[model samples]
Target: MKAFLASLVVALVVAVGAAWLLETTYQSTAADAYATNGARVGDPGHNLVGTDWYSSRS
Candidate 1:
């Protein structure tokens, strides 16, 4: 039982670390790709994920 608990803790730590690493990698890649194409990163005006329905522009 003790060994199983230790293994479980190790597995959890590895999974969390992998998730964090992947997120960081993805963000960096996205930023690099945008920069290569002359697009700005993190600009809400050019958000690709959602629409800005609240904007007052015509």
Candidate 2:
């Protein structure tokens, strides 16, 4: 049981490391993809969470 727990911990560590590596390698590509998708940074598109969150044009 102890050996199995140790192996599980090692595997989790390796998986997390691989995920971090991939994210680092593709960081720019991911950002470019998102930017190209018209999602524009800093623009979350107001959907009105409440009436008080917006002001009337009239």
Candidate 3:
């Protein structure tokens, strides 16, 4: 049980850290767009996300 708890905590920490890094990366860049079509940078209608959180709006 102790080992399980330790692993769980470690997993949680890693998950949180990864999420934070991804959020920061997404927010810091304006060239990337989280669109369903998966287009390249500098293309028209990139549908950029304005906020730090994930948005459904294109």
Candidate 4:
């Protein structure tokens, strides 16, 4: 039981770490693609034609 618990903990740690790494990598790639396409990162209206309704909400 102890060994199983230890293995489970290790697996959880590895899974969490992998998920974090992939998320970071994806964000970096997305930012690069956005910049390449002339869209400003983090801007809601970067590529939109009309006003960003979400940001314009009062």
lDDT string, candidate 3, 1-58, tens digits: 9999999999999999999998887564434554445655465445655557675797
| lDDT of model number 2 | 0.72
Best-to-worst ranking by lDDT: 4, 1, 2, 3
Q: What's the residue-level lDDT of 43 in candidate 1?
A: 52
Supply every candidate's count of residue pairs whose N, Cα or C atoms clash at under 3 angstroms: 0, 0, 0, 0
User: Which residue segments of model 3 deviate by more than 4 Å?
Assistant: 26-40, 44-58
The parts of candidate 2 lying over 4 Å away from their true place are: 26-58
Superposition error at 45 for model 1 (Å): 9.6
**In candidate 3, which residue pairs get closer than 3 Å at backbone N, Cα or C atoms, i.e. clash?**
none
Candidate 2, 1-58: lDDT as tens digits: 9999999999999999999997888556434567765765544445438656665775
Clashing pairs in 1: none
Give the number of the best model, judged by TM-score.
Answer: 3
TM-scores across all candidates?
0.46, 0.44, 0.47, 0.45
User: Candidate 1 lDDT, tens digit per residue, 1-58?
Assistant: 9999999999999999999988977555556567655675675446564654565687
* Top lDDT prediction, candidate number: 4
